[model samples]
Target: MKLQQQKYRLKLCQPAILPLAVLTALTASPILADETDAEKEKARVIEVIEVTATRQTENLQRVPIAVTALSGAELEQYQIQNLGQLEALVPNLNLHVGDAANAVVYIRGVGQLDSISFNDPGVGIYLDDVYLGRVQGAFLDVVDPQQIEVLRGPQGTLYGRNTIGGAVKFTSARPSETTEGYVSVLAGNYQQRGVKASLTGPLIDEQLAGRFAIAKSSRDGFSFNQYTGKNDYDKDSLTWRGSLLFTPVSEFTAYLVLDGSNQNPDYSRTPHRETPIYSLPSGDFLPVGEDPFVVNANFNDREELRTKGVALTLDYQLQQSTLKSITAYREMNYRTHLDLDGTPDASFGIYSYEDQDQLSQELQWLYRSESLSLVSGLFYFRENSWSLGGAIAPDFFVPLGNGVFFPFPVISAGLRDQTNTSYAVYSNMSWQLSEPLSITLGARWTSEKKQVSNSGEEFFGTGIDTPQGMQAVFGTGIGHSLTGYDASQRWNDFSPRAVLNYQYSSQTMLYSSVSKGFKSGGFNGRLTSFAQPYDPETLWSYEAGAKSLLLNQQLRLNTAFFYNDYKNFQLSRFSIDPDTGAFLSLFENSGKATTYGAELELQALLTDSLTLNMNLGYLNGGYDKLIGDFEQEVSDERELVNAPRWNGRLGLDYWFDLGSRGTLSVNAGASFKSKTYLTVSSSDLLAQPGFTLYDLYVNWQSQDERWQLNLFGKNLTDKRYRQHGFDLSASPGVQLGYYGDPRTYGLQLTYRYF
Candidate 1:
């Protein structure tokens, strides 16, 4: 097996800042751009520096940390609605859909890929300062983001759970003691449509204020089902956010935020690879009219996810220390059609499946000063899930003992109802020992347990068994297997992190840290005959980096190099079974992997009006050591699926004032990903070539900062590719999958009043 090599790319673009002539002409641009003379001076320094990278809000360049921040305006301008969008634009980070709202986010060569929610995320995703509890509902259809802060390296010290790789914080806009509102609309190809609205105003003068936002989008899916008739499939989604602000005293304030999202895709199941492709080299603009293979007709997979939460924060200022408390409650539900892949066949009989899930969580914390800071929190997560599956009668002459085959897909609908509970307590402290150095230390103890049950039919790959089949096979047992078994597994982790920082000067700092990460193990699906589950896996990272401002502030560079040692890496294994031409898969902890990577971010302000931003990420990753029990049907050494060794981005923006009436700005961004494996069996050769995507946006605002309009186009090059795919062995030669979308263009408008 060959290992993956290091790869990365960097491009140069014009600055995103405005030209001197334009800036000079815009002394009074759009209302939004026409900030107070004093306000303009402060913003000119850092473009609304973010606070998520570190625990405090300060000059971005002054923070001795590596981070990337996208403001609410930036997100709107770029149309970064989901994690997938972030992955395309950010370096090193990768997010792939796992069925529905379940997006697997891998960072710096570490992350979770399996469908089981029991596993922990190497990277943590946070909304409104609250940690998201599950992978299934983590990537909500989102909008109106205030700021998105991407902090590289281990953040286990403060963020606590599932922060082994790094952390992503999404801040939502809050209500102010004022009045404001906006509206946006988008229309495009494939019947794509989107609408968003936001309103915020005083309920009782300065004492109370409320803010609300709602967004909805739908588009006809690109895939076509031969059996479902012409023009099949389209995706639909909805997102909402609301906030309340109450501040009776100038020194004391309280913030409450409520947010949620829903997703329902017309086509949940992957199209069988044997199926047709849309717009091949022929540029037909439509998928082939007929199924190329006989097994492509049963395309039935469905999924729905709902996440709702409320977070409350209170802050108080005292003589010596400023105190803060954040409390939150959240509930998430996920349900999906059992067959993400096409059904076995009509002859296989009643091919059907479904899973229902519920998840809930809570967190709280407090912190003091930067020199002596303390943060502690309590977290509780619980989930209840159930799955039922059944399949049609099997086809005869499929090489079984009897010429008459029984319903093959399922002898009975597999049924499993499970309950899981996890709780953790964690704390962290950062201390400054002297003018030149500081240290941060933190740890968390987490415990989890689960219960599962199966009533009725067996698993598909459990080895077919029939009276005649068993007799023919020397009684190894008929395809029939039964179980009323209840299993429980529990474990605890003392996750820890420490970092030491040395300040060489006001503009630069060097830092090092050691951190650990883990993913819990749980039940595997029973699509076949019986059930299988694996053990938990763990990883430790040793890292060091430098944050600096060079070229007299013309350049801001931050880079980190890391060595990750993985133990029992959880991965899906596949092998061709004798009964079926297809490959079978079950999650297992196997092999040790060593990975090294570095991230480079450069922000340059060549002139007061022109600025350039570029980021590069390269990873030298492969399974350095591996030991496991598996059939010879698969290869051992290969690149991990969906992990691109290199990813990069370059962006440029130029701002201007149009004739003193409003502001005009233009920005362009491009992203590139090196070649990567789309499937586990890298040897079989189903991969995506390196692809680059480009985007551009132009905006104009009203004389009043209150009204603004934005025009955007994504994937200007119209790149075609697939992000992820999977195969199953129960049904011979049965492999189906999905791919990414094409270019999209739209316009949005907003109006603010205060």
Candidate 2:
């Protein structure tokens, strides 16, 4: 086996050295500003954040979990518009786009890479307390968000679904009683144009309220297609969300939310060829490219994705407790056409269609008292998903006797239909043993059942070109049945969590926790025949953390250390079919693994108008025992996929006060990540070297806070980096890579009224 040499030095300790040193110095130093009334009023102290990571609202600092919360204002300031842009803000979190319709997300180096309908995501995504059944629907634009929270480690007690790695929660803004609205317009390079608006007002006097928001964005393609004389990888999308709040009595309230998004982008999955042209054993050549943004593709079509959902939540407030119920229904439809070979001769192409829908219901009871707090919930979910796809490769060849080969075109089609149902009961309670100490215990019982029907056909030709030649091979040059299967699986798990907390001081807290998580198993939808189902994967995590407000509330620092034991690791990779010599993507149990990591977050108010924020993460560990295909023990030399050795971010924000006009603010930040492998095999050709990205933002607001203007730049240095890759050298003799967005600058204007 050959490994690619690292292009950059692996300064394993350099990335975290500066941040840790700075944090230590800041912790030892005194407050930078005096506590005078004017200074105190003008100073920007780290704001207190609220989160629902534990299935109940609580102070972020008080929550005994590893989590990060970002408010709407912070998101806007950071210029994060979608899920893929959030990789830099959070620790141990990785997100990227696999295709125009699928989002690949990973936390702590654990996640599902296959976009098959039968597989489940390791990192769960929830919007407005509704669990998204498919990752295709998880890439919607952020619109009118109240806050976004990322919970790290195993989240099995509260979020009982497939949250083995972690969970991400998105909370949208609720309807307000007062009448208010805002409109924003944006323009940038590459013919970028967008508009976003939101309005909230009282429908009836103190009885009803409503909120509506919409976002529309469009941008020219970044990649140039030589075959069509047009651009590829363009962006065009529209998303809208609406909600209504009803309150007949002060103790009773109901909220109904409706949301939808549509994305129609042109040829968004055209990956640039990364390998050199290769000559097959049959004397046929495969095309390749040198540039990452230039591609030659014979097939180009617009990809379409449509998603809609509705959720209703009801809450009844009592003297010391609250009872809440939520009901939600969501559905998605997606279609895509791609040229996999990246050539103009139609060497390889594919078309896919997906339809999915889900329904979920949840009930919760939250209770709070002077020395005790408790939260319990019941959840039920049902989903139906269907997928149809076809692939054609005319340059393929089949081997004959005596080292001879014949031209054999390969054509295949497949369909998968699956139904999944789940039920769970969970409860978490915290008891205050004393004024400064507490103990919490939580557990969840979950049962899931999955049923699937898969079928496919494959056709091979032996240099058959004419009508008579095709008639000799088969009646119609279509295909013969290659695969047909029906399967069902049932799984049950009992997850538990325990935490001990100690309030060391008024501004400092320490906590330790142990938790278990589970992910249900499923059959491979891309298989050539029926096979034994894989077993469920599970993880046990041990973590300790500290949350502190130091330097007299001018500085906030949070730190965590975690160790995890992962068993029955589910792995997805390409394997050659022994019978037909065709490439097949399948899933298997790859044995046990271990992962350990540390994270640190710091925020300091350097001066009355200046604030500094920084975060650093370190990860290490890999497979302890890996079982390869044919049940052979494989070497454990490859690094874990998507797990970088070092990652960090540093930023500064300063405000310049204009006496009578308004406030001018400048924000600058830089994010860096070490070498990362995109695939499970850890192929060097598909790896991303260490790189840093710099971003800047300048803002101006009117004195009345009703008018605002901003200018932002991303990837200021134009650092070229790969976001995803595919290695098909075994069959197609080609490697492909998808790159991150290049340098982009834009201006936005907004107006607000109340």
Candidate 3:
């Protein structure tokens, strides 16, 4: 249903419309929990084994690194699907601001903050060695996987660039040369429904093998928009993979992997989260019937996104070592028109973003031994993007005689053109001084550049009172409203790293490291007051950590402390271009800050049939000086915003052997997130507060490795919660944080052809 002209004033409708739409559709994140005996057989042996910490695959206890590993089994048992579920499995990790589908991942109390750009991320995401640039881009096409590893601390060593906040690596299930595949369907509350299946095995006997899979899910938004008539959100996805492994001789072999996926979601909304009339505050979960903000007036809205990519890898092994190479190309396009109607638009009419990311690269490496091993590689990346948005549309706030939306000074198109390129060479070496002592050394040199130009119309706001600042925003709209400003910068950086590792025993290890991390420079896509380019953000990191096994291998514990010195950090600022009411994103390199924190985790086999795990994280981070003299800068210094001060989680896993062929294994977990400021730069501390959430899951399997079943519950108590939000000032529009939904439950079943 179209929002009524009588209720939604122009300014009000401008901002809230898009945000509510997107937030609502994205509320649907992948969720599933079920297993058969064949799956159980694999799950029972070990939860997961990780290799991200060192490029070497070893038991979690033996790896000389600070790491958190989530097995495919653990992923399901907890019904922890996607990055959001990770809050409960990994220590000190939180997805603040945005919903489960769009997130800013934080680690060690420090992570990429306000780091949304066309070509950068404070942290890097790798899918088989191919980097996923934008943090938002990393959220889509999420697949039910084999395992995921969150490696903390500075990985400046051999992981490559943009890893200051560490890295997250996902390894999808590979094709088995000896067997085929299977399929499954799932149904749950909130109108959640899904279908998925895959196939693999011999195409030409022992000479070749391949696999392909597909999945789709949809659900009604927990935040109902009565004005829209339809439930607020839904997500649809599809993926495919094909592989060919060949062994021509006893000592020579090669493997090829081609895979990609697509995801479309229509969500974003606000349903009077809670009532001051009753509860009176922002952090509580309540049904629409019992709340105050549930009025049909305001809603979040956004139009589109499509992400797809393909990756290929080749591996060759000798008697004692392995060598590999990877090549990839991926593209993503996002086109959105947001009408921040309803709640509070302050008057900036429709704001929009139309951009696409096209990336390609070739990576090479070698690894032959665990001790006395060396790794080196080369990389190149390039991307192009465009955007059309502003507050210049005079049609906004203007009374609509009919049902047509007339922005104040419509900027039919706002464009920013940019080309980003980086070239790098890196090397890492390790040697064992003794069985108990080892030393690691690594270094990388990079040359990077970015050039940006603007070609479009300026609406009117005069950079003084708009999100883009006053001078550039608009009061009237017409012609090429943009100044053709272009800039290019070059950087040469040498990152050096060293690590000392000691094996106290077969069950324990200790390690310490020192390294430097870098995030390359980029053009400020938003309108800017100064003509200068933004400097690259850099970090010098120091860390010490330990891993150990206790109680006869019944428990595992890991912890780390880090001190980070950051300079010229890139921070996002919002202001209206005087020419338009639309918020203009401007950048300044004068940003500097320090982040220090601790991460601790423990997993215990409580009994012969029960086990438990707990994770905790803390951060003391903020800036030390004035970044610049912009109104937006005043708002940016508050607690570095999304980096919450505290985070923790608890998990319990239990298995009971039923009579004979039946067994019941139950896994449940709960997570706690401290009060977080979606827009930490805001002046009042009361604007944002701490919140807590809980979840649960269970699984049943036959004694054999063939049949399995899983039952799960998310937001089990229907805990009302908001993950992230934005409120643009000046004819300002307030897009409330996306809220976590009510109780959702489901059951899944699987069988294997082994």
- Selected candidate, larger lDDT, 1 vs 3: 1
Between prediction 1 and prediction 3, which has the larger TM-score? Answer: 3
Q: Give the alpha carbon lDDT tens digit for every residue of 1-754 in model 3.
A: 0111101000000111223343233223222325466644433232334455566566676665677877555554565545766765676676533432345776664565453354477667777667776655576344546668888766656675547777888777776677756665566766666666677777776666676667776666655566665556455556655556666665555666666655555654442322211111222222334432243422245535556677666666776766666667777665443434333222333444545565656555666565677777777777766555544333343222242223444443445667777788888888889989998888988888877775445544433423344324432443334455667788878888888989987777898888888877766665533345677777888888888776555567788888888887766655555644344555666556788888888877665456677888887777765354343344244666566688888877655555334555555777787776655344242244666666656555554545555566676677756555544432232333445556677766565456
What are the lDDT scores of the predictions, listed in order? 0.62, 0.78, 0.59
In model 1, the worst 10-residue window by lDDT is 1-10
Candidate 3 positional error at 122, Å: 0.9
Compute each candidate's TM-score over C-alphas. Answer: 0.82, 0.91, 0.82
Candidate 3 stretches greater than 4 Å from native: 1-48, 96-101, 113-116, 250-253, 266-302, 319-321, 341-346, 349-359, 369-371, 391-412, 458-480, 528-532, 576-584, 626-637, 683-688, 730-735
Model 3, residue 379: distance off in Å is 1.4
Best by TM-score: 2
Candidate 1: which stretches are off by over 4 Å?
1-48, 62-66, 116-120, 230-233, 248-254, 272-297, 312-329, 338-365, 389-407, 456-481, 525-531, 576-584, 627-636, 729-731
Ranking by TM-score: 2, 3, 1
Give the Å error, residue 585, model 1: 3.6
lDDT by residue (708-735, candidate 1, tens digit) is: 6566677887776766665532333234
The alpha-carbon deviation from the true structure for residue 255 of candidate 3, after best TM-score superposition, in angstroms, is: 3.4
**What is the clash count for each candidate, in the order shown?**
35, 0, 125
